[model samples]
Target: MKRRSLILPVMLFALLALVPLLATLGPRSFILAITTRIVILALAALSLDLLIGYGAMISFGHAAFLGLGAYSVAILSSHGINNAFAHIGCALAVSLVFALITGAISLRTKGVYFIMITLAFGQMLFFLGTSLAAYGGDDGLTLAQRSLVFGAPVLKNDVTLYYVCFAALLGAYLLCRAIVASRFGRVLRGIRDNPVRMQAIGFAPFRYQLTAYVLAGMIAAVAGVLLANQAEFVSPAYATWQRSGELIFVVVLGGLGSLHGAIIGAAAFSLLAELLSHYTEHWAMIFGPILILVVLFVRGGLTGLLGGGR
Candidate 1:
């Protein structure tokens, strides 16, 4: 990639890093909160882009990993195990297992069937969360405290948490970029473009695609861990089909196959929804049409307008 290609992503992160200083000048603390939320969701959407953009897998249940991560922290914290490493480990393990099982089954199908199976699995997890009465069930669960970093309340501070989220986003972006540029990425892209040809050449597209699916799940789970801490709560709704739609929208709105597009899309979607909700409770009623117009007209997404390609 050219140095100029990185300019936008670098500049965007720089702007995000400065947000804490800007928030200090204003009395509205919600600015920092919402900003953190966007970055967290951006991480989740970035994971989805890895599958949809690079692997040509349109998963409709990616939010299940997010919910799993959040619930992992919540459930573990409820048991007096709120260590950051512990939460992350549990979240990743569970997401990996879930993704392996679901992806193994879902990848057998193609196109709309794959989508429906993923959606079905996500809904199953959503209902499972709702059934856990000991963990607040339908009412959701609140954390007694955020995950502890070496027994310190690092994430308890908003600014510290914001930087942590920023670091995670940066790390996720770099890792995804590296993966997409590697020989493995080439094979995945080849599979996406021509699975039959790749199969003829001795590459098992199923195995490669499943690996990508599991990796995406694990990454999304990390976002969920941060999300649970940010909100200090976990809910079944986090894994709903609707949340999956929002993730897909973020990946698509930013442009498929471009990792940076996921970040941009998340930021735009979060800000747009925030602005619209103040005017009406049924904000989606308005936001829906706007999103449709973007998909219909913005052929390459916001990234295309900015002159980047996958």
Candidate 2:
């Protein structure tokens, strides 16, 4: 990787590491809460970057994995399976199965077809969540408690939870950085630029695309797990198409194909929403125009602006 590329992630993580300490100067609970949420969403956005940015696979139903992960925690906890590992395992297993089934079929198409199919799958899960009346249905479900670590309330502390989430974000960034720098990542990029040319060179685009899709889904699902734990609630709204759109917006806002860009975009999006909403309920009206301005004028998104172009 270029030394310039390392600059952003290094600075970003270093700043994130100081958040807990910084919180001591203000409303610590609120600070930790919002930051934890941003970190989790950033992880989700990073996974989407792997697909839309690197693999050129645009998915409109990526939020389904988020819903799956959240629901895994809710359903399992309700059934007396309060183990954190169990919830994570369930999320991964479910996300893997869903991604494999959906990706296999979605990879056969291109352009808008891929987008629509993913949206359809996401809506399917959303409707499924609404239909689960036993789990509170459209009203959503609240957890009696957070997941325990080794039968202890390790996550009960706000600061502890924040650090755990921060660690996950850091680890995920490294993992994705490794993947993007590997030979397989090069193949995905080649396929993104020209699938026909990649095929001519003896690479099967389908397998590579499908693999990327599944990996993205699983990673997003993990984010969902953290989100559920963070909010202590689960609802069908988690898988809504609007949420998926936000993820896309985040990746684009950060700059495509740049991992750390996702984190920057997520933080900007969340902080802007938080700040704007405090001033008026019509914050989205303002948010929409801001996104348009960024899309139109930001060249390569925030990362490009900061890094002097990708």
TM-score of each: 0.98, 0.98
lDDT of 1 by residue, 1-310 (tens): 7887888888888999899999987864799999999999999999999999999999999999999999999999999997999999999999999999999999999999999999999999999999999999998999999999999989999989999999999999999999999999999999999999999999999999999999999999999999999999999999999999999999888888889999999999999899999999899999888878888988778888788655
**What TM value does model 2 have?**
0.98
Q: What is the lDDT of residue 294 in candidate 1?
A: 80
**Worst window of 10 by summed lDDT in candidate 1:** 301-310
Model 1 deviation from native, Cα RMSD in Å: 1.0
RMSD of 2: 0.9
Clashes of each: 0, 0
Cα lDDT tens digits, model 2, 249-302, are 999988888888899999999999999999999999999999889889987788
**Candidate 2, position 207, lDDT:** 93
